[model samples]
Target chain A: MKADLVKTLQKKKKQILEIWMEKQLADAGLRDDLISNEELRIQSEELVQALVQSITEKNLGNVESSEFEPVYEILAGISLSRAKQGFSPRETGIYIFSLKDSLLQVIQEEMRDDPAAMYAETIRISKLVDSFGIATFETFIKGREEVIYRQTNEITEISTPVIRVWDGILALPIIGTLDSSRTQVVMENLLQEIVETGSSIAILDISGVPAVDSLVAQHLIKTVSATRLMGAECIISGIRPEIAQTVVHLGIDLSNITTKASLASALRHAFSQLHLEVRKKQKQQ
Target chain B: MEKIPILRMGHFLLVTIQVDLYDRLAVNLEADLVQMVNKTGARGVLIDISAVSIVDSFMGRIIGNIANMSKILDAETVVVGMQPAVAITLVELGLPLQGVFTALNVERGMELLRNRIDLDLNPEDDDDDAISDAD
Candidate 1:
C-alpha cells in the first residue's frame, strides 16, 4: 500500500510537470531543441512561471502602497513570455510627465508617434506598479467624480430641486440612493421641467430607492417647496413602510409633501387634480 | 402622488388639500386661490388641507385670503386637517394662513355653510371655480 501511494503521488506530479512544460514551451515559441527532456523542461518552466505570476498578483493586492500610485502586474502567458501588472496610479502619472519631458528628445530620435516606440513606452509604464492591488477610497471617489464631470455639464454640487411649472409634464420618478451629487442633478432637472411644463403636479417616486435617512427626506422636501412656489405641485410616492418608519425615526417631517403608495397612485393624483384624461397604454410597433 | 379628495361642495367650493399643511406650497396661497377664484367664479371656498404634514406662516396668510375671498364672492370658506408638522413647518418657514376657513373635514365645513346645509356638495362649485378662473 505504501509503495502504491508513492507511485500515485509521483504519477500526479509527473502529469502536472508535463502540463507545465507544454505550457511554457508554447509560450516561449520553443522548437524541438527546447524539449529534449520532457520531465526536465516541465520542472524548470513551472517554477519560472509560478514565480512571475506571484509577484504580479502580490502588488495588486497590497493596498498600503501609496493611494496615488498605480500598481502594475505581470501575467505569464503561453504566447507572450509574461505580462506586466498594473502600475501604481502615481507611476502612470510619472510616465506621462516623463513623456512630456521627452518630447524634444523623441523628435531628435525621429521616432515621433512610432508604434514600436509606443509599445516600449507602455512596457516601461508597466514596470512602475507593485501589482493590481486594492485602491484607496479617496482614489475611487476622485475617479468617479472625474467620470461624472466628463459625462454631464448640467450636474453641479447642489441637490436642490429646480422647478419650471408651466411645461405640463407630470411626474419625475427618481429611483436610487441620493448621494449629494446625484441629489443635485435630480433637483436641477426636476425644477427646470416643472417651470417649463407648467405642470400642476409633480411626483417624487422613490419606490426603487433602497433607503432614506434625514438627508434624503430633506432633499425631497426642498424639491416640493420649489415646485409649489411655481403653482405647480409635487407628490412623493413609493415610500415603503420601512422607509416611512425610518423617516419618522429620524424625526423628519414629510407631512407637507403629498406621499403616495406608488407611482401609479401619484400619477392618479396629478391627473385627478388636473382633471386630465388620456388614452391608456397606446401601443406602437 | 398625493390624492386630494375632490368633492363637490354644495353652493360653496371645498378643496381638500391632501399634503403637508404647512409646506412652502402654502406661501402666497391666498393670491393663488384668488387668481383661481377670479378665473373660476367660485362662490364659497373650503380648503381642506388635512393632508398637510405641517403648516407654515406663508400658508397661514393664504388661508386668511380664502376666508377673505368669501366676502368678495358671497361664499363661505373653511380649512380642515391641520397637522402638527404643518404648524411647525409654517412656523419655521414663517408662513401664516390667517382667517382662512378652518374645518376638520367636508362635513364640518359644509355645516358652516348656509342654505347648502341640507344639500349635497355641488360639482358646479369646482367646475365654475376652475372655468371662471381660467377665463
Candidate 2:
C-alpha cells in the first residue's frame, strides 16, 4: 500500500505540478509582485522533484527521517529566499499547503479503485506536508530576524558620531536612551577621535538624549572620567530641565565634572580653556 | 634588588615605573616615594606609568595611597602617560584616584606641575600672568 502511494506520486508528477500551480494562482494570498509566475513554477517544480525523490514506502509517514533531508533543505531555502524577497507569512504558508492539495487530488484520481488504501495514504501525506509547513515558517522567521539584527547594528554605527567642532574641541551629540553597551561605543569613538585630532577639550552634547536615570548618569560620569584620564577635559552639555530634575531627584552627584546648559555655552567654555576667541567680523556697508 | 628609582628634578620628584609592579615592589615604592617627597621637599610628584601594563585592585590602591601621602606632604601628584588599557582597568577596579591629577606625557606633566606650582606660590598674580601670557 505504501509503495503504491510513492509510485503513484512519481507517475502523476506532471499533473500534480499543474494542479498545484492552479491552486496557488487561484489563492487570494498569491503574490505576483515578490515572484513572477514563471519563477514560482520553477520553484514549485524543484521542490516537488525533491519531495518525490526523498519519499519512500517505509518513511512516508516519518517526516523526521533523514530520507526527507533533501525535501526539508529545499523547502527551507525556498521559504528563506521568499522571506528575503518580502513575501508575507500567509503567502509562504499557502505555497507549502497548496502542495498537499495537489498531491491528494492526484492520489485520489490514481487510486479510484482502492478506496481504503487511498484514505490511509492521504493521512500520511497530510502529516508529512504539515511538518514541512512548520519548518517553512521557522526558516522564514529566522531570515527576517537576521535582517533586523543587521539593521540594528547599522543604526548604532550611524547614530554615535564624533564631530570635530573646533580645532581643539570635539562634540558628540547623543540622541537616544543611554545603555551600558552604547556607552562603551560612545566612549571608544570619542577617545579615538581625541587621540587622532590631538584635541584638548571634548564637548558631549546630550540634548538629544531623551531621558536620564541613575544608571545613565553613571555611564556619563564614567565617560567623563575616562576622557579625563586620557589627559583631555570632557564637558557634558545640553542639560534639559527635566533631566536635571531627574539627576537631582536620583541623588546622582555630578559636582566634580563640568556641565553646561547648551552646546553654545560648552563651546564658549572650551574656547576660553583653549585661549581661543570667536570675534564677529564687521559687515561691509 | 629591583628598585624603582625616584629621581629629583628641581623642586619636583619624578618616578617612572619602567616594569610591571609586583605587590611587594608596589608597597615598597609607595614608602620610597613618600619618604623621597619629604626629603626633597618637592612641590610636585610626577609618576610615569606608560610602560607598566597590568594593574589589579591592589596596585590601584597603592597608586591612590601614594597620591594621598604626597598630598599630606604638601606635594601635588600628577600621574602621567597611563596607557589606555591601564586607565580602563583602574576605572573598572573603582579606583578613580579622585584627588590626583593626570597628563598625557612627561612633557605635559612638567608643564602642569610648573603652572600648579606658580598658582600655589601666588594665587593673586595668576590673572596678571595669564593676561601677559595671552599678549
DockQ of each candidate relative to the true complex: 0.04, 0.53
Measured with C-alpha atoms, the lDDT of residue A257 in candidate 2 is 91
Which lDDT tens digits does candidate 1 get at residues A1-285? 212222332334444344445444454333344324563354344533342333232332333434222221211121112112333444323322332222223222334446565445334323422222122223434555777886554433332343333235465656557776676567557655543443456777787678998878866776666455333457888888999899988999877778998877777777767667757796887
Give the residue spans of candidate 2 off by over 4 A: A111-116, A282-285, B122-135
A227 Cα displacement, candidate 1 (Å): 0.9
Question: Which residue runs of candidate 1 sit more than 4 Å off their true CA positions?
Answer: A1-145, A148-167, A179-184, A277-285, B1-135
lDDT of 1 at A219: 69
Cα lDDT for residue A210, model 1? 86
Q: Highest lDDT, which number?
A: 2
Per-candidate iRMS values, in order, are 10.8, 1.6
lDDT of 1 by residue, B37-106 (tens): 5665565677766565544455566666667765576556665544434533553364434334443345
